[model samples]
Target: MARLFGTDGVRGEANTAITAELALDLAVAAAHVLGEAGEFAGHRPVAVVGTDGRASGEFLSAAVVAGLASAGVDVLDAGVLPTPAVAFLTADLGADLGVVLSASHNPMPDNGIKFFARGGHKLPDDVEDAIEARMREPWTRPTGAGVGRVRRLEDGGERYVTHLLDVLPHRLDGLHVVVDAANGASSVVSPEAFRRAGARVEVIGASPDGLNINDGVGSTHLEPLRDAVLAHGADLGIAHDGDADRCLAVDHRGEVVDGDQILSVLALALRERGDLRGDTVVATVMSNLGMLRAMDEQGVTVRQTGVGDRYVLEDMLAGGYALGGEQSGHVILLDHATTGDGVLTGLMLAARVAQTGRPLAELAGVMTRLPQVLVNVRGVDKDAVETHERVQADLAAAVDELGSEGRVLLRKSGTEPIVRVMVEAVDQERAQAVADRLADSVRTHLSLTG
Candidate 1:
């Protein structure tokens, strides 16, 4: 059978690729696997479940709750919370498992199920595979009182916000910030958290009718946030995705500050305060060469990992690094979270601005982002990109042409049959031209239909 879980989780179109039945079955299987694996041997297994503001999440969360409860695992339903909030609550409440119903930055018609093990860490691949294999297996069903119970977690959001505030290195006093919650999970809590942290907060994209989440707002689409920040004359803008696990920002001048700049600023701030662990930052290969150069010049080391936040987290845990993230803004401050927390990233950025009395653009000046272009060629044999003679030759030529001044990367999509061609240079035109050539090469040599 095909794997249900992708790099992130079991994400797909709601009521189609992902359905209530699948959610229920996954929950039951997760409970059984976690129980048999000794997570619940001494006590009744407990799970903390949450979802984004997608309409599908309503039924999906209910299905997950029913499945876990039927399997004798008590459920704490944290409704309409961010993914990281669910993770945090799971660990804070000492639950055996955590589940979040969200497709993250995906549009409203899609949804997903993400599982976290004890300690609120994302489950390893082996554990996820075990859960999948256990599905449809026969097992004795619990009856009456032996079945688990479910309850609403009334203080879940408050607890999460409190945790965020408690971990801040500096407060956001005197800062006027705009927050775009993507009309999803972070709508209520994000604004409240900022206000509590002392920022004069203006909110946009906070209204959710369920179907409109991520429509034209959020981190993925920064135009709304940039315009909002400019119109409101705010010091900065923070944009979170559907589930708020990651964030990207816009400066006062309406320039989008991406993950590379964010990571660089935080790393420098931590280093200055003598809090940087090992003076190292872990990042994915997608991180810009300029960020790496900045870290190098600052006498800090950069550890590169694969594309996913999980891969970045694994490296951080292995090396005891204090910071890591992707270019897409999934940042993990190891001291604060086991996974990425968009709100936390935003707070740290804003606090840094307030502390230095520097504009966000100045703080982000810690790294100069290289002109980068990415071209995605779909309907291709992604596997062939690695070995196709023409594609490899084209990539090598691009690299040779750019030499030390630029970089080129061709990566295969883990979940889809697509090849991503990326090029970075000192000039935007060169980057785009190189990316187009590589993409054309990939299309020619690796066309799936051919």
Candidate 2:
């Protein structure tokens, strides 16, 4: 069977691939695995649990709570909070584990379960594997007083907001900001955070009836945020995913400011304050080449990782780097958060605008985003993308043709029989042309049907 966990966690359409039974089983396995690893040694174990406002999450959260409690782990049920809030509460309350019931930016029918270990850190692959292995294994059940207890953590959101405020470098007093919460978990806390930080906040996509998340809003959809920012004549806008673990923004002119630009701005700000460790920021291989160039010119180094933010976080933790994120706006400020916090990222971006007396557009202008085109070619032998002679030959020719002025990357999809052909150039036309040529080559050479 395939691994249950994806790059983030176990995710699927609710009630089907990710059912209440699976959530319960995974929670029990996780508790057992952690306990066996001595995470709960010398004391009773505790877990912090939260959920995005998904209807399916209502039952899944209950199942998870039941599983953990049955395993003799105390549960602090933080109802309807962002994933980052759960992580923060896990650490703040000295819990041994944290569980977040969310599928992040996925459509409303999809949901997932992700866990955090002690100190609010994402579990390493080995630990996740161990938990998966232990699932469905027969084990003795706790009874009587040995069964754990569950308590409602009514102040989770307030605690998280206070933490965000305390770490803010500067207040957003004079800024007019628009916040789009994706009608998900951040609906309340995101706007509240910006307001308390002193920005005049206007909100859209904040009304969650549990079925509207990621429905034409959030980071994946930028049109709503752009329209709102322009309509409000705001200094800028912030957009968060379903669980609010990722943040993307819009500038005053309704131009989308992506993660690369956000990272460049924050990198400079942190460098000036001597907070950028080793003067390096961690980014994925998918980051725009323009960002790399800008960092190089500014005397800051960028360490590249695989496509996932987890890989970026791994590199940051290993090198002790203070900043890292993906192009999707999953910015991780190591000094302040163990994982990506959309609310924190947005507040910090606004703070930079407030402090520098520069518009977000001006600050983001530190880098010029090269036009990038990606073509996903399916019905191919994705595993042979690298070894196939014709594909490699075509890729080489494209690279040689672009030389120092461009880049080409061919990556196979992890979950599907598709190969992604990505090309970046100084101009959109050239980028698209190169990408198309490579994708055609991949389809012709690696076609399984052929």
Candidate 3:
């Protein structure tokens, strides 16, 4: 059978691939698989359940809560919180597991269920496979008082915010900051956390009414945030994705700073403070060449991984690295979070600005981002693109043209019929022209005839 779970979790359009029944069954199965050890002495293993602001999440959350409780697990219903909050509560509240109902940065009509183990860490592949296997078995219905109970886990999110404030290396006093919440999970917690740390705060995309998540806002769309920062004469801006697992920022002049830059800045900061583990930051291959150059100048090492933050985190943990993230804004500070955390990343970035008394734009001068362009080539046998001599030649020529001043990347999408063609150079026009040339080569060499 085909797998329901993806690299991150089981995600799809609401009420379709991710139905309520599936959520229920998966929740019950997880309770059984993760709670089999007489967890909490058979006291009904506690589970933390939360969701983003998606309207579909309302029913999904209830369905998940019901399944776990029916399977004899107590439910800490942490309603409308970020994915990290669920993980944090799962560990802090001593729950057996955590389930977050979100699709991360995906559109509102899309949703998903991502799980965290007792310590707030992502489940290993073996465990996820086990849960998938168990999902096909007969459902267990605990009878009598053995059935679990459900209760709202209020005030728990505040604790997470407090933790974010407590861990800051310096306060953000006198710095005016703008926060774009993406009208998703971090709407409440992120703004409150930033304000508490003493920053003069302005908020955009905070008024989520479910359907508005990731709609022309958040990390994926930075115009509103940039405008807000400029309008308020703010020191900078931070934008959280749908589930607040990641953030990208804008400096005072409304220039965007992605996760690569954030990691670059943070790695240097931590290294100076003697906290950076091995003086390294783990990032995906998608990171810009400018980041690499910046780190190289600082004597910091850049470790490359595949696209996902999970892969980056795996390498970080394996190598005892403290900082890792992706170009798409998922920044994970292993010292503070078990998962990617927009709030934590934002606070830390703000703290750096405060500590140095330098504007975010000045600090961002640590890296000069090369203009890069990504073009999607579709309707081809993507697997053959790399080995085809014509395509390889195109890539080689583009690389040669780029020389030391640029880079090129051709990546096949994991779940789509598309190959992403990316080129970066000293200028945007050169990057776009090179990318267009490569994309044309891919089409000519690999285009499908229907």
Candidate 4:
């Protein structure tokens, strides 16, 4: 059988692949695994739980709570909070584990379950595997007094907002900012954080009715945020995904600022304050060539990993680096957060804008994004993408042709029989042409049906 966990966590369509029974089983198993690992040696195991306010989350959260409590783990139910908030609460409250019921930026009908360890850190692969293995194993049931208790954590959002404010380097005294919450998890706390930080705040995609999240707003959809920023004449706009673990921005000129640009801006800001540890930042292999070039020119080093925030985080931790993130806006400021916190990222970005007296566009201007084109070629033997002779020759030719002014990357999809061909160049036309040629080569040489 395929592994239950993907790059982030176990996710699927609600009530189908991710059902209430599965959530319960996973929770119980996680508690058991952690308990056996001596995490609960001297005290009863405790867990912090939260959700993204999806209608399915109502039932899913209940199932998780039930599982944990029945397994003798006390539960602090933090209702309707972002994924990072749950992580923070887990550490703040001294809980042994944290569970977030969310599908992040997925469509409303999809949902997911992810866990955090004692310090609000994501579980390592070995631990996740152990939990999965223990899910169906027979175990003793806790009796009356031994059963864990559940309590509602009514101040979770407030506590999280306070933490964000404390981590902010500068106050947004005169900035007028617009926030797009994706109508998901950060609907309330995101705006409240900006307002308290002294920014004149306007909001859109904040009225989540459980079904409207990521419908036409949030980071995935920038049209609404751009229009709102232009209409309100805001200094900048911040967009958060469903569970608010990622953040992407829009400048006052109504131009969308991507994660690469955001990272460049933050890298400079942190460097200025000497807070960028070792003057190094971590990024994924898929990061734009522009970001890499900008960092090199600025005397900052960027370490590239595979295509996942977890890999980026792993690299950062190993090197004691202070900044890391993906192109998808999952920025991790290691000094303050154990996981990516969208609200914290927005506040830090705004603080930079306010402190330097430079517009977001000007700060983001440090890097000029090269035109990038990506082509997905399916019905191919994805595993042979690297070894196939003809495909390798075509890729090498494309790379040699692009030379110093551009780059090419061919990656096999982790979950599907597809190969992604990405090319970057000085011009869009050139990038697209190279990417198309490479993709055609992949299809012709590696076709499974052929």
Best by TM-score: 1
What TM value does model 1 have?
0.97
Worst 10 residues of 2 by lDDT: 412-421
What TM-score does prediction 4 earn?
0.95
- CA error at residue 190 for candidate 3, angstroms: 1.2
At residue 318, give the lDDT of candidate 1. Answer: 94
Tell me each candidate's TM-score. Answer: 0.97, 0.96, 0.93, 0.95
lDDT of each: 0.93, 0.94, 0.89, 0.93
| Tens-digit lDDT track of model 3 for 1-450 | 555676688888999878999999899888877876445564558888999989999999999998988888889889999888788888888888899999998899899999998889888778888888898487657799989989998898898998888789999999899999999999999999999999989999999999999999999999999999889989999999999998899998999988888888888889989999888899988899999998999999999998777788899999999999988888888888888988999999999999998888888889988898999998987878779999998899999988998899987765346888989899999999999999999988898873
- Candidate 4 has an lDDT of 0.93
C-alpha-based local distance difference test score of model 1: 0.93
Candidate 2: list runs displaced more than 4 Å: 378-390, 413-418, 444-450
- Candidate 4: how large is its RMSD? 1.9
Model 1 C-alpha lDDT per residue in residues 201-318, reported as the tens digit of each score: 9999899988999999999899989998999999999999999999999999999999999999999999999888999999989999999999999999999998999899999999
135-164: candidate 4 lDDT, tens digit per residue: 978999999989999999999999999999
Who is ahead in lDDT, 2 or 3? 2
Once all C-alphas are superposed, what RMSD does model 1 give against the true structure? 1.3
Better of 3 and 4 by TM-score: 4
The ten-residue window of minimal lDDT in model 4 covers 412-421
